[model samples]
Target: MWTYLIHGEPTPGVARLLEGVGRALEARGFRYSPEAEAPNLVLNAITEENPKPYRRRAQATFVASVLELPRFPEEPIKELYPYLVRALSNVLLAYVPGEGAAFLTLELGHYREKEGEGFYERVAERLMPIACSRLVIDNIFVPDLEPELWEGDELTESMYRAGRKLKEWDLLPAPFPIEEILPPEDLRHVKRLYGIGGLSYGNLSVRKDERRFWMSASGVDKANLKVIGRDILMVKDYDPEKNAILLSVPPHVEPRRVSVDAIEHWMIYREHPGVGAILHVHAWMEGVPATPFNYPCGTYELAQAVAEKVREAPDPTRAVVGLKNHGLTITGRSLDEILERIEGKLVRTVPMS
Candidate 1:
């Protein structure tokens, strides 16, 4: 799962040293085992820990540790730990030189899942700005403070309890999805959706899935939202004949024009498959291109520029600051992921003078 380099005083009994390393690792959510028993001369002995564990043993070396992640070797422990220890050994090392054993612990923060879709890379690319943002809420505001048990894809009350306990440990929620409390009229016909946003800053509307790409009725603000039948706005339903072609226009509305942003929303869905939802905002310094367009202004150049920007992006799913002068487009299987990106991007930006 992760790796850590522990530095300490060498024990007269090598076996004791091994045991101490194992216990230290276990305390910090890692496992360790000695690799060479007394026989191999090259190494003293070996052992393994839960999840993933590794050990290194060589004669005349007090340097030993537990490793689980594959990418760790590129940045081995012996070299990294000493520097960390030189600075923190006084407070962190567990043993005294003549008294027995002590190790300077070097833990891998936040294990990144490496097997699928460059998840860690994506997180690194996307969250860097948020990780260093100024708009971050105080650690006290973090919700669900404990480690959530995966309850078949849904979090439960017990999980909530665990989170509360974790709060006692000071580990706050690192990221959460964005939420907009919409009104009843817009949500009446909706079955399922990912992202939710305020209509008039309070009334919320959600995009529908599986049937049509219907959104919420216009003029439904969240503050005074009422769950009435007219709030739902069913824009398009599944044709089952034309390969999922999306259609707009309700045919009966007065001004006849639905949200002008709908076409831009559709363009994103067409370009990126598996995009569950889209959030288009007309924020300042965003949503306006720097150069002039030759045609009706909705040119292929914008889409190409966006694709290129994301392709070159450090994180594919992250929201770019000033994408082609357009606001921002984020995608995710869940709404929180998208929201986290939004908040993170906002935090990363420094106000321009």
Candidate 2:
């Protein structure tokens, strides 16, 4: 059983919202307590007018508000809030104050009865799992690579053939039920990788051994990368002298080329055995360290420059290097470590000048 305390002043609408939220929780076997119970969660809801005019691109005029969890005296509640927000679809902001409390803001429009039920259902689905498990959710956001402006006929044919081969091997899974795991807002990242709506630009790699690593294939939709052999390529036989990076395609499987960033990943892994994973994303991060030179993408010079920067970095295990005018290359000791480092930094596109 779990206990909760509802915080914030109650307006008529807010009161009704709380009741709806309570019913949703009760349906899931969670109980509410008026007394301050140890290990209890708080639901802070607020209703306020939009202080500034909505942006020209904004879809709605009104905004709903959910406050962040206060700094609980216990460490578990304090640590649990961050993971909770990751699964909430309506979360607007999850901010942590340096000296005080951490809070989450959920934006809602003017609340009607139907809307209230939907909102409570969303909140219950996202929060109950964490509340029960008492574990932090480990969902990582890997940004998608932008669509390549040009595609050769041969390349398209090759991808089609590979897709068929994947089907024959029974490697592709059904469309991901992200709603079961994450909130709707978080689904955008998954959709991008699945190629549902837009082209995603990025490559993810995991080191298999000293000789090889597994990486996303060039032109493959990342969102569909739910299964291996169909969505990923095994990169092997790295020969720096010849700049040859080979894929471990099966005996009957048609060969697929590794990501363009393979060489850069190879150079880093070859130099740093402790590095276990690498992620390359196309976006501009405000404060990550940048490479001194801007080399063209998919070139030997670019790979060499990136490797050199990684060697120079104080903490290569968690270092994120900016590829001037291109994107970012991040390395970590393991995949989880890599995800933890790039968690909030993944973005869809670079701003235009």
Candidate 3:
């Protein structure tokens, strides 16, 4: 059974709602636990007046904060999204009695309601993917020979230039406002845990060799990637034994984790040798095939689903696939080729399901 934790204070309405949600989850095989033991998910209920965060834990722990908004705003994104992040939880659930509820993750923003009944069951259904998926984020760094690999290689230069192009197109969304949103103590915890100052959207990578590629570092500015180990690192391979992405970084510099989506990229690269490069952006394209479910990033399930979509494409090397409630993952001969093809055809606002 999957273990979970529900924390924070809630109002009468939220408590009753949580009771139903908890029961539904248990019926579907979820066991509640305390903070001391590692749990698969944590549902944090917070009040607007005291929007406190749960203690930091491994990235694998999915922390979703729930809040009750009286007569929830018609446009919650503009009116009340900041407070959700203020809770420092990855997913936010905003609920109202007569009006229904809305859901927001670090990725897409989705609003849902039930005119008839079973709203609680629907909410629990939407959370199933996140509650079940495993995050393959463990990383191993080796001080392997090759300053030339990460320093000034031609492919590496293309990575830098591609980052600039993405910035120019405004494809890279702003990194999360961790410092502005979290308290001083909680802020330190995040940095220490993730080795990242903030979380950002989109990651691009170009093939370095037959088995490896260079990827952007986790939680760094995609627009301005300058450092070797800090901003960009070479993904050597995915280690099944460790269930981690292995990287070859400069021996002198401290290495951070590669993009959380590195496993997804690794799977595609391994499956399609002709596919030379991959570009993932938080933007959409019309008429593109998207995954059926919105699985959490970095999971083997998501990787397998996206890879299957690419495999089904007429040309896996040059295909554009949409990630439902997420964005697009494009494959091309190089980053430049991917950039050229997607120049005029991109939807900035990704549609949520």
- Predict model 2's lDDT versus the native: 0.49
Please tell me which model should have the higher lDDT, number 1 or number 2: 2
Model 2 agreement with the true structure over 27-133: per-residue lDDT tens digits: 88878775643433455454222111111111111112343333332443234323433332222222222222222222111111123326666555544433442
List the candidate 1 regions with Cα displacement exceeding 4 Å. Answer: 1-257, 282-326, 344-353
Clash counts per candidate, in order, are: 30, 13, 0
lDDT of 1 by residue, 1-353 (tens): 32323333323443444354445444544433333232111112211221111122211122223222223333333433433222211111222222322222222111222323433243222222211111100011111212221111121222223234323333332211112222343233121221112122101122345433333233332122222223323334322342122333323322111222333334444454555444433222333222221111122343344455444545444434233222343444334344445442332221121
Per lDDT, the best of the predicted structures is 3
Error of 2 at 210 (Å): 2.1
lDDT of 3 by residue, 175-264 (tens): 877688777887788777655567788998988788998888888889877777888888989989878889888898888788989999
Clashing pairs in 3: none
The deviation in Å at residue 253 for candidate 2 is 1.8
